[model samples]
Target: MTKSQKWVSFLILSMTCGVIYQVAYIRFVFLGPTARALDVSSQDYANIISVFGIVAMVMYFFGGWFADRLSPKFLVVTALAVTGIADLYLGTVPGYWGILAAHVVMAVAGMGLYWSALVKAIGMLGDSSEQGRLFGFLEGVRGVTSTVVGFVGTAVVAASVAEAAGVLWLIRLYGILCFVYAALVWLFVKGDDRRLAGLGSSTVTLRQLWRAARNRYTWLIGGTVMLMYCFYTTLGYFSPLLEHRYGMAAALVGVIGVVRTYVFQFVAGPAGGVVVDKVTRSTPRFLRWMFAGCALIALSFLVLPRDSAFKWVALALMFALCLLVFASRGVYWAQVGEAGIHPDERGGVIGLASGIAYLPDAFLPTLSAWWIGDPSATPAVPEQGGGYTALFLFLLAVALLGLGLTTLTDRTRRRELAARAAPAGAEAAPLAA
Candidate 1:
C-alpha cells in the first residue's frame, strides 16, 4: 500500500476498532442483571461498576505488553471478533449469571487489544505536529461511532423475542458485524509495524515497563485518570439518572444520551482539542494549567439546584460537563505521545498507560450508583435521589479528585524535569528506576 493509503487505512481501522469495543462505555449490562438478581440498590450498582475498574487495571497491564508485542491490526481485529462473540453470548445466554459472564468475556477481549495499541496506531498516522489533530479526530469518531454501535446493539437486542433465545438473533447479527469489521481491518489496515518488531526487542523489557510504571509522573497521571472518572462517571449513567429523577421514559432518556453524544462529541469535542493544543503550545508550564482546569470542570456541576428548574438547567450542566471531558480526553493521552519513545515502545507504553489510566472504569460505575442508587434494580422510578442534584454532586467530587492528582503530578514532574535539566544531571536521574 502507498503511504497515503496506509494512513487512511490506519485511521479507518483504528476508529472502527474503537467504536466496536466501546460497548463498555455504552452501558453496564451486568450491573442491571446483577441488580435484579440480588435485589440491590443503585449504591450496590456503583460497587459493581467499581469491580470493572479492578478488572480493567489488570487488562490494561497485559494489554500494554500485548500491544507492544503484537501487530496493531492483528490484535485489534482479534479483539473485535472476541468481543462480538461475547455480544452474541449476551444475546443468547440464559440467566443473570449468563449476562455477567458475557461482560467478563468482552472485558477480557478488550484487554487483549485496545488502548495503547490503538493510540500508537493513530500516532504513527502522523508526525509530532499532527498527533493532536489525528487523535482529536479519532475521539470525535469514537463518540459518534460508538453511539451508533450502542444504539444498534441495544436495538437488535431489544428487537428480538425478548427471551434469551430470541435475543440470539441480535447477538448473531452483531457477531457477524464485529467479525466482518475485524476481517476488513485485517485485510486493509497497514498501521504501524513497529509494534510487530518491538516484541523481540530488548529495550521494552519487563524491566523498562517496571521502571516506567514506577515513575512519579506515571503514577500521578494514572491515578488522575482513575479519579477523573468520578466526575465523568456521571455521564455514563446520566440517562438513568434522568429516568429516576424526571419520570422520563428510559427510551426518552436514551435519546437524550444520543443527543449528548452528537452535540458535544461532534460539535464541542473538537473545539476542546484545539483549545488544548493552543494552551499547551502557549503555556510554559502546560500540565499545571491542565491540572487547574480540572477544578473548573468540578465547579461546573454546581449550576443546578434539586427542586428548581429541571430539564434545561440539568441538561445544560451535563452538556458542559461533556464538553470539559471531551476537551481534556486527548490531552490526557498526550503525555504518552510526548514521552518520545522508540516507535516500538509506543504500543507497550501506551498499553501500560491505558491499563493504569482506566483503573476507574472497573469501579467508577459502582461508585456512581452508590450516589445514585443500585445499578441492578428495576428501572429507577422518578423523584429519587438518583436524580440531577445527587448525580452532579457525585460528578463534582470526581472532578475534584482528578484536579488534585493533576496538581500533584504536575508539581512533581516539574521539579524532576528541572533537576534533570540541571548542570549536575546525575542528581536528576530517574527516581522511579
Candidate 2:
C-alpha cells in the first residue's frame, strides 16, 4: 500500500472502531439521563448493560470465527450498518424492552462482528514488527475520535432545551456517523490478500481454534484483559461519584468524564505503544508494571477521603489511573506477537481471549449496581460508606489480580523465547568455540 493509502485505511479503521461504542460510552456520561429516559431505576439500567454484556460475550467468540473466515470489509460494513440502525433506534428513547433489544443488536454488531474484524484488519495494515505501534496508533486515533464525540455530544446536550432531547440527539448523531463510516469502509478499505481472510479449511480452522482455546497463555492474557476491563468500566461510576460526593453539577461531571475517559486516551495510547516498542520492548512486561501502578492507584482510591476536601486529589488519582489503563489497552494485543502464535491463528486466539476477557460485561455492571447503589440517591457519608467502599475494594482486587497475571504472562513469554533460542544458541556455541 502507498503511504497515503495506509494512512487513509488506518484513519478509517480507527475512527470506525472508536465511534461504534457510543451507545455504551454515552451512558457513562449521561447515566441518570438514560435511566430516567427508560423510566427505570439505575440498577435496572445497569441490568440492561449486563444483558448487553452477556450477549456480547457470546458474540465475541462468534465474531472471532467470522473474522477468520469472512472478508473483513464485509464484516465491518455490516457491523457499522447494524450499529447505525441500533443507535437510531435507541435515540427514539424506546422503553426498557426496546432499549434492551437495541443493546442486543449493538452486541451482535459492535462486540461480535465489528471488534474482532476491526482488530484483525488492523493487524494486516502493518508488518509483524510494527504491531505495537500499529495497535497503539489504533488506540490513539480511537481516543481522538471518541474524544470528538464526547465534546460534541456534551455540547449538544448542554445546548438542548431538555436533557432527554439532547441525549436523543447525541445518540442519533452517532448513528449517522456509523452509516457514513460504513460507506467509507466500503470505498476505501481494499487489497484483501487471502491471508488477510485467515484462509484455512473449516477443519483446519476448527483445529487451530481448539488449539488456541487450550493454550494457557490465552486464558492468562484473557484474565488480565478481564481485570483491566474491570478498571475501565468502573471508571464510569466516577461520574456519579463526583456528582454526589463533590456536589458537582451534572454538566461539569460530564466534562470531567470526557477528560478522564477519552482525552487521556489520546496521549496514553500512542505513548504506551511507543514505550512498549522502544523502552520495555515487551508488551506483557510493560503491562505487568502498569498493572502495578493500577494496584497502587486503586489502593489510593480505597484509602483516600471521599469527602469534599479531597475531591481534587481523587480526580487526580482517577486521571492517573486512566493513563495507566488506556496506555495498557493500546498495547495489550501486542501480546499476540510475543506469545509466538502463528498469524493464521490470530482470529481464534483473539476471539477466545475476548470471549473470556469481556465476561465482566455480563457481571460487573450488575454487581456494581448492587455495590455502589444509586450514587445520586446515596451520598458517601462516613456513617453510610459501604457502597463506594465496596466498589473501590473490588477495583483494588482486580488490579492486584491483573498485576499477578501479567507478571506470569511476561515470564512465560520470556521462558518460551529462551527455550526456542536454546538449540540455536547451542549450535552457535560449538562453531564459535
Candidate 3:
C-alpha cells in the first residue's frame, strides 16, 4: 500500500478500536439509565467499573510485550472478536458477577491484546517528526467515531419502553459493530507485522524490558499519564454532578456527557497535534502548558459557587476543562518519540508506561464514589459541594504533579541530547586538527 493508503487505513483502525474498546464502560458512566439497568448502588457500580481497570492494568505489560513479538494485525483481530463475543453475552444483562466476568474478558481483549498493538501500529505509520500529527489525527478520528456511536446508543435507549432493554440493545449494537470492524481490520490493516519487524526485534528480551523500565524518562512520562488519566476518569462524575447538583434531567445529562466525551477530542486532539508540531515544537514544553491549563481549570471548579447564576459559567468552564484535558491526551504520547527511546523497544516501553500510568484505574472510581457521595441519596446535601471541592482539589494537585514530572523529563532529555552532540563535536574537531 502507498503511504496515503496506509495512513488512512491506520486512522480507521485507530478510530474503530477507540469506539469498540470503551463501549461497555460508557453506559456505566452515563449515570441514571446505567444505574437503573445495573440495579446497583453507585458504590457497587464503581466497584464493577474498577474491576476492568484492575484487570487491564495487569494485562497491559504482557500485552505490550506480546505486541513487540506478534503481528499487530493478528492481535487486533483476535481482540476485537473476543470483545465482540463478550459484548454479546453482556447484552443478556447478567447478574453482577456475570457483569464482572464480562469486564475481565474485555480487559483481556481490549487492553491486553488491542491497546498496545494499536498504539504501536499508529506510531509506525509515520516518522518521529510526524508523531504529533499522526497521534493527533488518530485521536481526533476516534473522538468522532465515539461521538457518533454514543449518539446512536443514546437514541436507542431513549426510544425503548424499558431502559434496561434499551441498554441491552445498545450493547448488541456495539457487539455487531466490533465484529464488523474486526473484519475490516483483517482486510485493510495490512503488513503491520512485516513493517514493524523491520523496525524492532521479532522477540522481546528481558534486558530490553529492563532498559525501558530503568529509564527515568519512561517513569516520568508514566507519571504524567497516570495523573492526567486520573483527572480524565473523574470527569465521568460530571454527569452525575450535573444531574444531582444542578437538577439536570438524566437523559439530557447523558447527551451532554456523550458530547463532552468527544467534542473536545474532535476539536482539540488534532489542534493540539498541530500546535505541538508547529508552535511548541517540543512535546515536553507542550505538555507543560497543557498541565498548567489543567491546573487552572481544576482551580476554577474549586472557586465556582453552586448557585443558579453560576450554573452556565460552571458548565462552560467544565467544557473548556475537558477540551484542554483531552487535548493534552492527544499529544502526550508523542513524548514516546521525543524521549529518544529505541523504536525496537517501544512496545515494551509503551507497555511499561501504560501499566504504571493506569494504576489509578484501580482506585479512582471508588474514590470518586466516596467523594461524590451516593447518586441515590435523596435530598441534596451540603456534603455534595464539599465532596466536589475535595475532588477538584485532588485533581488540581494531580495536574501540578504532572507539570513537575514533565519538566524533569524535558531537562533530562536536553542533557542527553547535549551529551550526544558534544561527543560528535569533539570527534569532528579531532578530524579538523
Candidate 4:
C-alpha cells in the first residue's frame, strides 16, 4: 500500500479502537455505571457527558491550532497514550468523580487526536477536489468500526453473564485493548514524516484565522454542522428515549443504537458524498438539495407529537432524520472547499467550521434532560430524564435556522458555476468566490 494509505489505515484503526474504548464504557459512566453496578440517574449521566463535551471543545480549538504549529504525530500518539491511562483508571476507579475526571482526560486525548495532524494528514493523501469523498470514506469506516466493536464486545459481555468476574474482566479488557491500540498507532507512525515536515515559516496568522471564522459562509456552514450533530447526538440517547416511552429492554435499545450506526443513518454519510459529486457541476446550487433535506427533517420533528402514544413514531422520526442529517453534514464540509477557500487553509477552515459547529455537544443533553425531566412525570425517575417537548422544539428551531443559513449561501453564490469558469486572476470574479 501507499504511505498515505498506510498512515490513514493506522489512524482509522486508532480512532476506531480509541473510540471503542469510550463507547463500550459509556454504559458504565455516570449514567449507566454497570461495572460499579450502580444505576445512576440519566441527568447525572448527561452532566458527565456535558463536562466531556465542554473539555472536548477546548481540545478541538487547541488541537487544531497545535496541528498548525506542532507535530500532530506526537500530539496524537501522546494523546492516545494519555487516553489509555485514563481508560485504565476509568474502569478501575470506584468513585463517581474519578470516573468523570477520567472522561475529561479521554475527551481531550480523543479530540486532540482528531485535529492533531490526522485531519490534515488525510487531506494531503487525496487531491483537494476529492475532499468530500475522502471525508465520507473516513466517516463511513468509523461508523463501521464502532459498530463492529460494540457488537463483538456485547457478545462477549452478554455471554459472560453467569460469572461476575467475566463482566469486570470485559471492562478491564477494554483498557488493555487501549494499550494495544496505542501500540498500533505508534508502530505504524514510528517513522512517519506527515507532520510539521514542511511548510517552514509559512502559515496563516491568528488574525487570518479570526477572519475565516467571521466569514458569512463560515457561520452558515458551521450552523449546518451544529444542526447535523444535534441529530447525531440524539442517536445514543434515542434508545433510552425508546425505553422510557415504550418500556424496552437493554437488548432492544442496544439493537437500536447499532442499527442507527450501521444500517439506519451512517450509510447516508458516504452516499451524500456521491450525491455531491454528481451535483457539483451545478456548484453551490447543490446546497438547495441540502436545504430541502433540512426542511423535511424539521417538518417531521414538528409533526412528531409530544405524547407517548406516538413513541413508535419517534423511532421512525430519528431513523429517517439521521439519514438526512448525516447526508447534510457530509456535503456541508465539502461545500467549504467547493466555495473556494484556499487549500492551504483547508485544515483551519475545517477546524473553524468543526470547532464552532460542534458547540451544541457542550450542552444539548442537559437541555434535553431538563425537558421531560419532571420528578412527578413517571415512576422511572432516573429514566424519565426530562422534557421531550422543549428538546424537540429546540431541535426544530435549529433545523429551521439551518434552512435559513443555507438560503443565504444559495443567494450569495447564485452564479457559482458561471464563476467557476472564470480563469485565474480574472477581474470579474464571482462575489461569493
Candidate 5:
C-alpha cells in the first residue's frame, strides 16, 4: 500500500478501537441517568468496573505476544466483532452477574485481543520521527468521535420517556456502530506481507522477553503511564464531585463530563503531540513538563476553599486539570519510540508496560467510591467537599512521582543513545596501515 493510504487506514483503525472499547462503560463515567437507572450503588458499580481491569491485566501479556505473531488487521477486526456482540448482550440489561460477565467478555475482546495490536499498528504507520504526530492525531480524532457519540447518546437518553429505556437504546446504538466499524476495518485495513513473513519464520523467545523486562527504561515508561492513569481514573469522580459539592443538576453534570472527555481531549491531544514534537522535541522532557503541570493543578484543588461561592473557580480549575491530563495521555505512548525499543519487541514492551501501568484501573474506582461516598446521598450534606479534597491530595502525590520518573527516564535514555552512537562512530574510523 501507498504511504498515504496506510496513514489513513491507521487513523481509522486507531479511532475505531478507541471508541468501541469504551462504549460499554461510557455511562458509568458520564451519564448519571444510566447509573441511576441501573440502581446500583457506587460500591457495587466500582466492583463491576474493577472486573474489567482484573481480567485485562492478565490478558495484556498474552495479547502482546499475540500481536507479535498474529496479523494486526485480523486481530483488530475480531476484537471489534466480539465486543459488538457483547454490547448487544449488555443492552438486554441483565442482572448484576450478567452485566459483570459481559464486562469480562469485553475485557477479552477489547484489551486482550485489540489494545496491543492497535498500538503496534499505529506505531507501524510512521517511522520514529512521526510517532508523536501519528499518536496525537489518532487520539485527537478518537476524542472527537467519542464526543459525538456521547452527545448523541445523551440526546437519546434525554428524549426518552424512561431513563432505563434510553440507556438500553444507547447500548444498542453502540453495538450497531461497532459492527459497522468492524466491517470498515476488514475492508480497508490491508495485511502487512513483510511483517507476516517475519512472523512466520521467527517465534518470540524467552530471551527476547527477558531482555524487554530487564530494560530499566521499559519499567520507567510503564511507571509513568501508571501514575498518569491514577489521575485519569480519578477524573471519573468529577461528575459526582460537582453534583454533590456544588449542587449541579445531573443532566448538566453529564454535559460537563462529556465536555471534559470529548472537547478537552480533542483540543489537548493534538496540541500535546505538537508540543512534544516541536517545542520539547524530546518525549521525556515533554512528560516532565506535563507531569509538573498536573502536580500544580492538583495542588490547586487541595488549597482552594470548598465554598459554594467559589463554584466557578472550582470549575475553571477542573477544566484546566482536564486539559493537562488529556494532553499527557496523548504523548505518553510516544515515549516508546524515544526509549529505543526495537520494532520486533514493541508489542511485548507495550503490553508489559500497559498491563502494569493500568493496574490502578482495578482499584481506583473502589477507592473513589470510598472517598466520595454514595451518589444516592443527599447533596445538602456539608462534608462532601472533604472527600474530594482527600482525593485531590492523592492525585497530587501521584503527579509528583510521575514528574520524578520522567526526569529519571530522560537521563537514562540520553545515556543509552550516546552509548549506541559511540560504537558506530568508532567503527566508521579508518584503520592506519
Candidate 6:
C-alpha cells in the first residue's frame, strides 16, 4: 500500500477498534448508574467484570493464533457483527444472567478475534522504525473516538427521564455503531490479507507457537505489559473514589469519569510515541523511566486526603496518573517489534504477551471489589479501612516491578544489537553495567 493508503487504513482501523468496547464495559464508564439501572450490587457488578476477564483471558491466546491463520478483514468484521448483536441484546435490560451471557459473547468476539487481529494489522502497517508512532497514533485516535462517544452517552443520560432508560439508549447507540464500524472496516481496511498471509504459513503449529511463547523477550515485555495493565485496570475505580470521598452527584461523577478515563489519552499517546521513537530511540528505555515516574505518583495517592476541599487536587493527580497509564499503554505493544521476534512469530508472540498482559482483567476487578469492601461506604469509615488506599498501594508495587522488568528488557535489547553488529566468529564486547 502507498503511504497515503496505509494512513487512511490506519485511521479507519483505529476508529473501528475504538468503538467496539463501548457497551461491553458500560459499568466502568458509568459505574454507579449502571449498577442501579441493572439492580446489581457493587460486588455482583464486579463479578460481571471478572467473568468478562476470564473469557477474554482465554480468548487472547487463541486470538493470536487465529490472527496468524486468518485475514484481519475477516476477524474484525465478524467481531463487530457479533458484538453489535450481543450489545443490542444487553440493551434490552436483560436480567443478571442474560447480561452475563452478553458479556461472554462480547468477550469471545472481541478478545478472541478483533484484538489480536488489530494488533497484528497495526504491526504490519509500519516497519520496525515506525512501531512506536503507529501504535501511539492508534491509541490517540482510539481515545478521541471513545471520548466523543462518552460525551454523547453522558448527554443522553442528562436528557432522559431515568438513568436506566438513558443507559439503555446508550447501549442501543453503541450497538448500531458497531455495524457502522463493520462497514467502515470492510470498505477501507483493504489489501492486508496478502501481506500478513505471506508473513506466516496458514498451518501454524502449536509447537511453533509454544516456542514463541518461550522466548525471553516475550516474557519480559509481557511482564511489563501485565504490570502496566494492572495500573490501567485499577484506574476505573477512581470514579467511585471521587464520588464516595466528596459526595459528588452522579452526573458530575460521570463527567469526571469520562475525563479521567479518556480525555488525556489523545495527548498522552502521541507524546509517548514521539519520545520513544525519536527521543530515547528505545521503547523499553522510555518505559523504564516512565514506570519510575508512575511509581512516585502512585505513592502520592496513598497519602492523599479524602476531604472535599482536596477533591480537585485528587482529580488533578488522577488525571496525571491517567496520562501516564495511557501513554504506557499506547506504546507497550511496540516492544513486540523492538524485541526482534521473527516476522512469522509476531502474532503468536503478541497473543502470548497479551494473554499475560491482560491476565489482570480476570482477577483484578474481583480483588478490587474485595479490597474496597463496599463502594457505598464512606471513605473515612475506619471499619472500611479506606479501600482506595489499599488499591493504590498495590498499584505502587506494580509500578516498581514494571520499572525493574523494563530495565531488564532494555538490557536485553542492547545485548541483541551488540551481538548483531559483531563480526562473524568475534566475541561481542561487554561494557560496565
Cα-based lDDT at residue 408, candidate 6: 87
C-alpha lDDT of residue 297 in model 5:
83
Clashing pairs in 3: none
Superposed on all Cα atoms, model 4 deviates from the true structure by an RMSD in Å of 5.1
lDDT of each: 0.57, 0.80, 0.77, 0.60, 0.76, 0.81
Q: What is the TM-score of candidate 3? A: 0.85
Q: Residue-wise lDDT of candidate 2 within 1-433, one digit each (tens)?
A: 7778877988899999778898765777787776775577888888999999999888765766677678778889999999999999888877889988999999888867888788778877776687768876787788888888888888988898887678888889999999999999999986447446443322225666698888887898788888898888777888877778766777887788888878877888778988998998888788888989998987888888768788888888888988998898777877887788887786678767877888888888888877777777755334233687788888888888887888788777766666777878732222210
The alpha-carbon deviation from the true structure for residue 120 of candidate 1, after best TM-score superposition, in angstroms, is: 5.8
Candidate 5 lDDT tens digits, 242-294? 77666666667767878887888778877888899889898778888878988
Error of 2 at 16 (Å): 2.1
lDDT of 3 at 134: 73
User: Between which residue pairs do clashes occur in model 2?
Assistant: none
Q: Which run of 10 residues does model 3 get worst, by summed lDDT?
A: 424-433
lDDT per residue (tens digit) for residues 26-78 in model 1: 44322343243334455643554455556656766566567667766677777
- lDDT by residue (312-371, candidate 6, tens digit) is 788888888888888887788889888888977875677677778888988898888777
**lDDT by residue (tens digit), candidate 4, 1-433:** 4767555554554354436345323542112324233224556656777788888877766765666666555665666677767766755644668767877887777775544556665554445576656665667666666666666555665566542333455556666666665566656654335433543322445765677776766776676677667766655656555665555555555556656655533577667767777755432355456556655755665566545677677777767766776676556676676677776666566667777777876887666666656322364455343355456666667666766666676666555545655565445544443
User: Model 3, stretches more than 4 Å misplaced?
Assistant: 1-15, 27-29, 64-71, 117-137, 161-164, 183-204, 342-348, 379-386, 415-433
C-alpha lDDT of candidate 3 relative to the true structure: 0.77
Candidate 6, 384: how far from true, in Å? 4.8
Q: Give the residue spans of candidate 5 off by over 4 A.
A: 1-15, 65-74, 117-137, 162-164, 186-206, 341-348, 379-386, 413-433
Candidate with the larger TM-score of 2 and 3: 2
Q: Give the distance in Å from residue 388's predicted Cα in candidate 6 to where it truly belongs.
A: 1.3
Q: At residue 401, what lDDT does model 2 achieve? A: 85
